[model samples]
Target: MASSVTKEISYEELKALVGKSQNLLLVDVRTKDEVDKGRISGSVNIPVDSVEAAFAMEPEAFKAKYGVTKPPLDAPELVFHCQMGKRGGTATNTACKLGYVNARNYAGAYKEWCEKEGK
Candidate 1:
């Protein structure tokens, strides 16, 4: 069973994890239009509304649809973010319920990312 505790990721921690590539899956829970404006590089857009179904997909099906391999239940780190973080927190909860034990929300989100990056 997955823990009930909600996990969160800091911008500094997320920043450090970004370049390692293989160790984490960055999921953006913002809409495609919002994501079009900008997003944390290396993050995949998976609008919050579709999160449950998306995670339920067969790995091949998910990859075919999203163009990225689906992270397994035990994936090292499955990080979610949105423009300001609320949706990301919701997505994180959804993922956790689906057995993504390592799921975390980037509480700072893209807004913080942009501010930190001076954009």
Candidate 2:
């Protein structure tokens, strides 16, 4: 896979998206245990280590596993996050490598989500 610049989204922008019913997929790269505590309301968990494989799966298989449609390669809004930001960056890179050109990292991640939500 070729190296590619990882795009990022700000907390403000993410908050706006979450408030809308737009075509968005927020992939949480946290472990099940961590995610079990809480997450951005509409996000999905697909642990960091499995990002590449998850994106590689056929759409049907992905849907079966993730319970959401597998985003297409050209999906306009594919965002990844984790406890903080590091793993989110890693997952974004992985997606970019697989040709998800619009994939982005939520730089503030779940911690920022909780803080902003006053959790």
Candidate 3:
């Protein structure tokens, strides 16, 4: 299914989902430089620039490359985040453009995460 819009998740909702949802895939869209400083504990770095490439990868290849299960194009609850809302929003738009119907952006990104969850 082609997605016309990107979904959104609040910091509190995302935090709760992280605690409770094993099926969640939290992707960090920040660059490697930003990630080198620190990142959320369970987030896998996809870097926004490479989102299309990641999605284009074959199922096994996507898993091998990203270290996470590759959900189908119409999969539910695939989320993206970055240092702030901007990159994450862009990445989510990119994912949706690539036909990832459930692509979601965590608007209150790493900065907000730090405010709520700390270093």
The estimated TM-scores of all candidates read 0.94, 0.94, 0.90
Across 65-86, the per-residue lDDT of candidate 1 in tens digits comes to 9889999899988999999878
Q: Give the distance in Å from residue 63's predicted Cα in candidate 1 to where it truly belongs.
A: 0.3
Instruction: Compute the lDDT of residue 6 as modeled in candidate 3.
Output: 62
Off by over 4 Å in 2: 1-4
Give the per-residue lDDT digits (tens) of candidate 3, residues 1-119.
22447679998788887857877889999999999998988889998889889888899999888888897887767889999788898889988888888889998899999988766
Model 3 ranges with Cα > 4 A deviation = 1-4
At residue 23, candidate 3 shows an lDDT of 72
lDDT of 2 by residue, 1-119 (tens): 22449788999988888859577999999999999999889899999999999999999999999999998889988999999899999999999999997999998999988998899
What local distance difference test score does each model get? 0.91, 0.91, 0.86
Instruction: Supply the TM-score for candidate 1.
Output: 0.94
Span of ten consecutive residues with least summed lDDT in model 1: 1-10
Measured with C-alpha atoms, the lDDT of residue 15 in candidate 2 is 84
